[model samples]
Target: MTRGGREKDRDDPERKCIATGESQPKAGLIRFCLGPDDQVVPDILGRLPGRGIYVSADRAQIDKAAKKGLFARAARQPVKVPDGLSDLVERLVTQRVIDLISMARKAGDAVMGYEKVKDWLTKGSAATLIQASDGSERGKTKLHPPEGNGGFIGVLTAGELGLAFGRERAIHAALAAGGLRTRVVEEAAKLAGLRGHLPTRAGGHDGGVTAMKDT
Candidate 1:
């Protein structure tokens, strides 16, 4: 499994992380490229032109790469790493995930609100259950995710989820199976790894990951 708890896809292109030296799917890693000024630039969309440098999605790993000069070593030249590189990656990745979720909502492949999500879950139309990480544990426990990999996502906060749904706040949402659903899961796994929302083997409403309780 990747550090994001995602099963490795044999068909997906693989890259070796500079920090851990582990080869994994590119989707589970953050891509970087050298800017015109020889500065290391994050390629969140992975469309940047240049030789790509990869690191696992984990924040600690990114930090290690930045502080330990691993990026320069990988580039085979001195490169300027931005301060707070890991935080920048986290913010960009968070927005990427939010954007994907918004697209899914616009495509009518997603639904929000407790009742709607519950209905989808009951009908077996929901491929993934999304709950705010900071939502009330008791309230979140009222629903359960569908069975399968990528069936639950709890790394996003209520306000962040609200942004995706064009609301002020949201605690529950469901996604139907589709291309967008797969992308959401993949990007969300990256965000999860960055935010330290590691998946546990068991327990909690968010599939196998532990949910954060808001008091």
Candidate 2:
């Protein structure tokens, strides 16, 4: 399966990574644009207007691109690379996820709390399940992610998920299908890649009482 969930679509827009020289879907790559001062800037939202350079989302690849002067080479001119480009990308992606989830909640397309999430799943209203990575595995296992690809996200910690839900903390959440879910999945894919994980379903049996893990 593609790390973003589901098989690769041939029609998807593709870009080549300057570091790896391999072309991949934009979903798996980060775009860089040259600033007015000719500094290489990581454009997490990919909306910058200029010639765009691409790099795979992996930290090592991004670091290699920066350390080996790949961006300067790609730009074909002197360009300053910001220190800790990969770390900045990671932070941006995480914030993008949080913003997306918050929007979804405001749109009435998402739900949190164990019982509410389980109810949505039982009623077949939730298209994706999100759980905190640092949450208790025992409690997490009590709720199964929706079946099939892109059904689960385990990349965020409890505090991070809490931020999205506007709560002190959250361990379980569910998203209904819509435009927002698509954006969430895409941003989550980038976050997952930077964090070196491809989200997989949480493994556990139903009917077991479990407690949420402390963050």
Candidate 1, residue 195: the lDDT equals 79
Clashing residue pairs for model 1: none
lDDT of 1 by residue, 1-215 (tens): 66544687788789999999989888789999999999999999999999999999999999999999999999999999999998999999999989999999999999999889999999999999998876767788788898888888888877788889898778889999975988888888898888776643221234434324321
- Model 1, position 117, has a per-residue lDDT of 93
Q: What is the lDDT of every predicted structure here?
A: 0.85, 0.83
Candidate 2 whole-model C-alpha lDDT, 0 to 1? 0.83
lDDT of 2 by residue, 81-186 (tens): 9988899999998999999999999999998999999999999999999998767786888888887667888888777888998887788999998759977887
TM-score for each of the candidates: 0.91, 0.91
Q: For model 1, give the 10-residue run with minimal summed lDDT.
A: 200-209
